[model samples]
Target: MGHYSLGVDIGGTFTDIVLLDVQSGDHFSHKELTTPDQPELGVLRGVRILLKRCAVQPQQVVRVVHATTLFTNALIERRGAVTGMITTEGFRDVLEIGRERRYDLYDNFLELIEPLVPRELRLEVAERTEPDGSISRPLDRDQLLAAGQKLKTLGVESIAVAFLHSYRNPEHETAAVQMLQAQLPGIAISSSAAVVAEIREYERFSTTVANAYVKPLADRYISSLEDSLRQEGITAPLFLMQSNGGLVHTKEAKRLPVQLLESGPAAGALVAAQFGRDVSETKILAFDMGGTTAKLSVIEDGEPLVAYTFEAARQKRFRTGSGLPIKISTIELIEIGAGGGSIAHVDHLGLLKVGPRSAGSQPGPACYQKGGEHPTVTDANLCLGYLNPDTFAGGTMKISEAAAKQALDTVAKTLDMDTASCVPGVTDVVNENMAAAARVHIAERGGDAREYSLLVTGGGGPLHGYSVAKKLRLRRMLCPPSAGVASALGLLIAPPKVTRVTTFSNRLSQIKIDALEHAYQELEASAVQTLKESGASSTALVTRRYADLRFVGQGFELVTELPAGPYGDSTPDRIRELFADEYKRVFAITPPVNDVEIVNVRIDVSGAADAKLGKQRDEAATESRVPVRRKAYCPDLAKTVDMPVHQRANLVAGATVAGPAIVEESVSTLIVGSHGSFELLENGIIAVELNTGDRA
Candidate 1:
């Protein structure tokens, strides 16, 4: 009997499943069109297909890991359960006020994302807790009951309770939850402290509300998936990928679905980081361009950057403070609406514009022949001969070149240009858009993108990576095997981990070693419990501590790692020195007279999973294979050229191909520009090195 593991990643346009043999290191993958109405349908379909193809029995699968963009879709589509919020009396408008900062300071009519909970649904209760965790006013049971009754009358399916200072003392919020659960039986309720026990009330409240809004939907979906899997005789443990590139059990995922908002993207980053580690590339730019969005992240020192906060459903895609802020640990990445299914059209200014809107799986692109009329990035790729019309989706899903031409023709007529001319423009626009976003993202992180190697993943990533990399002046790019479904691979590689944080506001000089130790002990205990519940063994657990520190009066804090120890009087000084070092590294200067304050304490507990899989070494090709030549539109040359098409499977280690070529794989295609060269590495990765001096 052979043991195996299954990983599934559900995206907007496709659900990808990968089955890995634990002992043999064999892997098979399948991609199915996503059913937006019920994403699990696509997941199950892909899983069954992959299993049957691999001849693997359900019982042989020992672990099942999954990642999805369902919660994020729901948030963006405003399709979550009808939700209401209950907050401390005077803070009912915190979600709306949101620091009163405009994302676009110059735009007179700048619009912000509408609050998920409207003012009418944002009720207030009479309760108060001071910043020091002292009760200033007790919870008024009558007011809470009244609020519950009103919420019930309003037909709210879920409720969120966010009392001010609940991060320091959750007792008031806990009492309110108990009362609401009793008064409003069968309704889903979430408390801010339980969701994010950190200082910022607005961010905490928003995160809790977001969680509650999606809780019912996530619970139902997860239950349905489990039941379906059981019926299929796959009774393996199910784990969900989190936004922080960690794995959490399905039960915990349902309780905190907000943590899974960026789960799929995070998985891509994790895989990119792992690939970087394997190749000894410490600095990498992970580029994931799927059917609906493009995500970019920075990986340094074998780890993806992690941020303590994220914005969801931003009105301005590139602008901060334009969305609902959620206080949760997440892989720091920049996402833009640039993907294969992104619709293209001529804007009011008579200029071609690529999307922020996607056709999704239902309509897909015009080439899918599913009655979509609009031209899309995929259609442009097809028209430009970048995609295979006959062998698309491994020949299972046929693409219609006629449909693609017609769609592009319609858009070209609007621009008064030929379809061939318009095709390159579309591709160039989307690539430049992604490159520009990546540039801004890297620059903001205090790094130059040109200094990093690009690791491309996702269905469309390889197809567009070279062009984007060229725009960023990047000289090297890598497309690993199974790049199209890298997120699913990432699920298997991720560890079972939990991160817990609590608000601890104290000046460094005023901090007591005993109090600090106690706080960490509580956090570690909670993490241990979570890891146990997630099926990780206690013996394999590892714990690390960090504190969010800043000079007094600073608006934000930098995370500083702490040493594990039995606290002595010298510990405070040691921590202060660590903070100073980090501060200097980030800002290039540390204030000599400024007092440092610790605002939040975080503890991360992780347990390594059995991620060992067999590797198959690639042998050198026996002979130099002749490339199939095809007439393809070359954007750099502004004309059609005979481009070499090489089947990736036929290439072996040390196989090198040069210039204006297409490396075709069943799942994706890698386009080498006029001045680029590609070599197959021993590990089955295609390493494309570009001449930076070339125009294309």
Candidate 2:
């Protein structure tokens, strides 16, 4: 039987599935509305659709690599299983106490982020380990067994074990877990040492607890998916897309679902990187706007920037320390509530406001006629002539113009404006919100967004990308072919990877070089074994080393990469020089000589790049045919005008379309405005060049 590989990504609104022929790079894709109540339902449904479209039998499928936001949604909605935490006697309140810093100092009512685990549920045990891995007091077996018995009686869904300094010596935590397993046979257990293995007791414990909270759900879903696929006669080893822009075994992902929290958006960054390589630009801003949210990520040198820790499901939107912090490496990206499903309405002050709320896929936008009465971003686009009502979702779902008009009229009346004026106003407001978010995000990262090109993807991205880019003063925008499904396509190209971190505090000047080298070697060996267990071949193994370093007096540190070679074998002078350089890069200056400490060491293992990794560019290929032109309004120039309507399949590589045109594809449409033009690139990407002479 011919073999096929599938890449599936489940987003808030839609579940995307891409099936590819193993030898050939040819692929087929399907998009189905996600069943939020039962996300796996949509996944299975999308897979079936993909198989039928590709004319492949289930047994012919070789492997399936998937990414999903299910775990993230559970955390956001606070729907995950109830979880309990076990910590050293005095540290039971770490999750509750948090950093104890107020985000807004001036506010009369300072709202503290609620702890993931409540105080009553946090159980304590008598166990202690020093930073140097010396046992201060041995574990009290009776105390641990009683805690386990109490937890079992409490009906806790899962348990997190985070004793003092577990990162340095996990013996106590591991022993406690072993005892708990004997008492509580089916309870899900997680330890800070295995989850993050970093300093900062509060942060590490919180991260592990969060991981434990989602463990059962993630494991069940992944197991169900595997069983369903196996029953269908597909036997290929399953891989999963991770937040770090790489893939890993499904089994490994189930144990540490926190790493997969940002999986969907990370895929978009990968696809953006591929696009950047095509144009010879290493710096890019990946803009992925889908039905429920928009994601923005920075890419430099063909790699998506990574952050060691991230917060999820913030009670306060757009603020740090307001969510559950996960201590796992992930592609650093910003997500906002501006997307196709974002509702537009006039607030109490009569000012038109776009959303931090969405209609999502169930009710969707009013244009979808799915019982939604609110005027969403999609409705605004439809009313403003930016979308083809009848051709939405490739005509599988016909849109209702009447519903869109009615919804827009309600907002218009509330704002004391006509529908015609309200339509553009809504779209403009939403576009500005997105641009503002991008600006704040870029500024915080010490980068000017104007210097980078915007690579737009997702269903609504291409429609609003130009205006957003204009707001940021970016000259060019690129709407890759199948931009709406780019995240899923990115999954097809991701390589298998895994990361492990260990906290070992020491003065680089005083520590024995040989001892440090030995520790690093041990970490590397563990990483290699994990990769192999996850199906990576010996020849495919690749490793990268990093250190979390800072001045001895500093409370926090930045992650810096070590030069390729044997880790920790360098001289003290070399180590000091490297640290100083990185410190200067981050803080613009280095501290005077005192002492330097390396708090953590991280190792990442990535498999060899897939043979079918890159996209094919048939530069010699031409557009098949051109369709007739049509009249479409151009809001950029603030006028209704005639515009060319071209089928995406018929657009050749050299095909050029001036401003005021709609390039229609099965997944989404690209709107070239009055002052803009589009030309197909060497690949299938559509280069949208604005009047500034820069193509996006």
Candidate 3:
């Protein structure tokens, strides 16, 4: 009669699974190379292996939460379902005529995300909704049926129905969906209003198309995985992590898979926030670097920032407006240079470049002996002796130093340098790439990197955290006890959260408070219902209100949380002040005018949370442990040094290990530099404090 919750995350390079004892706070984790051809197979295998190792019965699992990067990769790689679009007449070309703004004007052949539905498959239907939430011309069931029949004949797996101004009045979109579902029972249908009930028809259309694109894939994967788990004797209720860093029922995820685009990375950010608050560090930069990519998120006041709109499948990783606009609530993060498996190659200009591309799992880093001929960050670390070949991945993943050196030697010959020189270059270039991108993101938010501690997680984060922090001039870093599988742990720690949004435009001076209150109440009820459907108890539900506001003539809006409200006469003034404060916070200037307008209203409801992450340190029973000497390359000194190596398991609370040391765990390793010291905090966090003089 044990209470256990299982969490699993599938990444581009690896699949991570964790089993937590909700009663005793004990946990066991496992990692393996991802089976790209069938991502869920790897996760299923990893879970079985972990449960077997811990001698726990599969039936003991009472809850299961899963997150994966499969959806995001599918969208970026254009591997999603074949989808068709059924839109209002003359607006069928809206997907092609997006925004009409060039992301990069100078490039003649600039690549943009291709419309998910080809023009041939984008059929037109006769229907219209007025701008003011009224039906103008509607009830063209014949045209809608004709379009559905044509799409089915074209062999489309799903269809997106988006009519102009559907966000304001959804009746046309809803009626069209019902008609399509009745005629084409086999096809999945997505409505723009149901997916994104906000302003801007272009973004709504794009997001609806995206949901249709991923629906078939998610349905197949989730249903298959659930059946497989049940056959394996684990009859737990299954849940999924969404991009907004919240858990949702499997049904909800399948119905709206676009929301899961950043699920895996979102969990990492959540775990970082939890650890940030545990040690009293309210502001932190969460750095999660895995085999294929590194994701950076900012946590302020012990919570990760949440954004409603973000682009996907960008041609330029850091450039705004270079990708398909996706309107969904997401934990804001900037993804840049990849992790250990990121390839390193000399550019045509004779300069070395670390990755936006990676070797991934099929042929990971050269050290993995998996047929990869390219040198990668992991290969460089292995060649430099920072990674212990005998202890990597719990010694389950065998690595070859000779192979790593051979890969580095090839890159060195091109630069007319020795392998030793090229090894450090790879690590340095990758660190700089990550730091540079992170700096831009932090600065955009008006934050200084030096003012925040770097909370590092993932298989490769700890190995490079010190270098990245140094480059950013950060004074401190934190690598928690179970950093490698932090995402899976987060799935257990996260609560079920539901978000509802609507377009409600009105100038501040002329707005109706009673109408606004009515809108908020409706939104709250919808969100609360969704939470309940996700199996959350109603008693402890918490609701938060937000407003997307802007100056009267501004094109974009700033999101601000509304003060708790039974909103009344006084609420408008308070809201106006909040909008002004937020505007100033973002722009660092007084508002151009006191005239403000509310563009949208949003509500978020969070269910009861049972945080299961371990709070107590895994301390040694009685004795203190000593470190053994190991020779590893020192990047700062540009030479090899005999560094003190210690097993992370043996380190107790309050134990301090000084510079030029190695802290090794089965799944990950931490390399402390000569300029800093690693202190084991009472809360099981390893705080890396750099010497103040090192800034010189």
Scored by CA lDDT, what does every candidate get? 0.87, 0.82, 0.88
Q: Any runs in candidate 2 off by more than 4 Å, and if so which?
A: 567-569, 611-624, 693-696
Instruction: Show model 1 residue runs off by greater than 4 Å.
Output: 613-625, 694-696
- TM-scores, all candidates, are 0.97, 0.96, 0.98
RMSD of 2: 2.4
What tens-digit string does per-residue lDDT give for candidate 1 at 1-696?
A: 548888899988888787877776656677789998988888888888778766778888888899999999899889999999999898899988888898998999998788888899999989889989999999998999999999999999999999999999999988999989988888999999999999887788889999999999989998999898998889998999999989999989988898999999999999899888888898999999999999999999999999999899888887889988988999999998998899999999999999988998889999999988888999988878888888786555999889988988988999999887788999899999999989898888778888999999998999999889888999899998888888888888889989999999999888888999999999999989988998899999989899999888888999988998667899988998999998888888888655789999998899996575344222123355777888887655667899999877778689677788898876778888887889988867889998888434
Clashing pairs in 2: 476-695, 476-696, 477-695, 477-696, 478-696, 623-652
Query: Tens-digit lDDT track for model 2 on 636-685?
Result: 77867777777776676886778778877777878777777889887778
lDDT per residue for candidate 3 within 1-696, as digits (tens), equals: 859899998987888888888987777788889999988788888888888887889989999999998899889999999999988888988888899888998989988768988999999877778889787787589878988998999999999999999888889888888888888888999999889999987899999999999999999999999999999999988999999988999888988899999999999999999999999898899999998999999999999998899999998987788899999999999887578889989999999988878999988888888899898999988877788888787666889999989988888999999888788889999999899988999888887888889999999899999999988988999999778888888889999998889999998899999999999999999888888888899999989999999989889999999987798889989998988888788888965587889999998889876656764232233355777787898756778999888887777778677898888876778988998889888877899997645444
Off by over 4 Å in 3: 615-624, 692-696
Using alpha carbons, what is the TM-score of model 3?
0.98
Error of model 2, residue 80, in angstroms: 0.5
Error of 2 at 269 (Å): 0.7
